[model samples]
Target: MKRITLPLTDEQISTLKAGDSVLLSGTMITGRDAAHKRLFELIQNGEKLPVDIKDETIYYVGPAPAKPGYAVGPAGPTSSYRMDKYAPALLDMGLKGMVGKGRRSDEVIDAIVRNHAVYFCAIGGAAALIAKSIKKTEPICYEDLGTESVRRYYVEDFPCIVAIDCEGNNIYMSASDISAPI
Candidate 1:
């Protein structure tokens, strides 16, 4: 597995390829459709965005409330396609990577290529395991949205795989055409 630090440099991001396993470490922000919609609307209305997305990675998730003694609750990726409409605009604003599950729309894939960004797929149904990688979690904005609020998470060795590389090669597309290794 390749190890990558967050707030990735262009060189670091360019080196990754679709289907490669990655152990990601550093600060990542979490959001879902609600948060993305709000951010996009803020931009459209000529208002300041709540957080700077430039060269940053956004995870598509709506985590459950944290339990006592825990930094975050079961945090898992939501369907990436749900954010497809908002992704291109965010990508245009310098968002560099996305973490989620499922295939993205053509528009999002186009934006990924145009913006030199990447899309990662975290293992679905592993929310509890995923939460273990989070060292810290604090709400950043949209608190009224509760679980859908945008939050910043400090993570370590968070596992994921490159689903779509910057060049638009999608692992998910190829995976279906090939047999699983025995």
Candidate 2:
């Protein structure tokens, strides 16, 4: 397993490979489908996004409200394919990484390769456990959207697997290939 800090550089991203387990620490922003749509529309109209995503990682999670003593509650990764429509454009704009669950679209994979970015898969069915890694959370924008709002998260030892790497290797496809009988 590897340990990575947030706002990964090109050198750091290049070192990742699909199927590698990693523990992430530091800051990452959160956004889900609704927020992504807004950002996409802004980009389409040539308007500036409220939050700058350059060289940052966006986690696809709509975190639950914080419990009495916790930063967040049952914070699990959302399905990444839901944001496929907007990911390529974001990646083109210097967005360096993404964290979520499941496979990504081919277009997203192409974008990752084109931009030298990486995609990580958080464990499904482990939302409560995942929340333990988040040390702090603050709303950034789209508050009206409730939990779907974009937020900044300060995390430590957040576990994930490299689902797709800068070289365009995809663990989803690799897993499928391995399971397919000859």
Q: What is the C-alpha lDDT of each candidate?
A: 0.92, 0.94
**Candidate 2, number of clashes:** 0
Candidate 1 per-residue lDDT, tens place, 3-111, comes to 9999877898899999999999999999998999999899789899989899999999998878999989999899999899899999999999899999998899999
TM-score of each: 0.94, 0.95
Per-residue lDDT of candidate 2, residues 5-106 (tens digit): 998999999899999999999999999899999999999999999999999999999877787988898899999999999999999999999999998888
Cα lDDT, model 2, residue 65: 78
Worst 10 residues of 1 by lDDT: 173-182
Q: How many backbone collisions does model 1 have?
A: 0
Residue 36 accuracy (lDDT) in model 1 = 92
Native-to-model Cα distance after best TM-score fit, residue 130 in candidate 1, in Å: 0.6
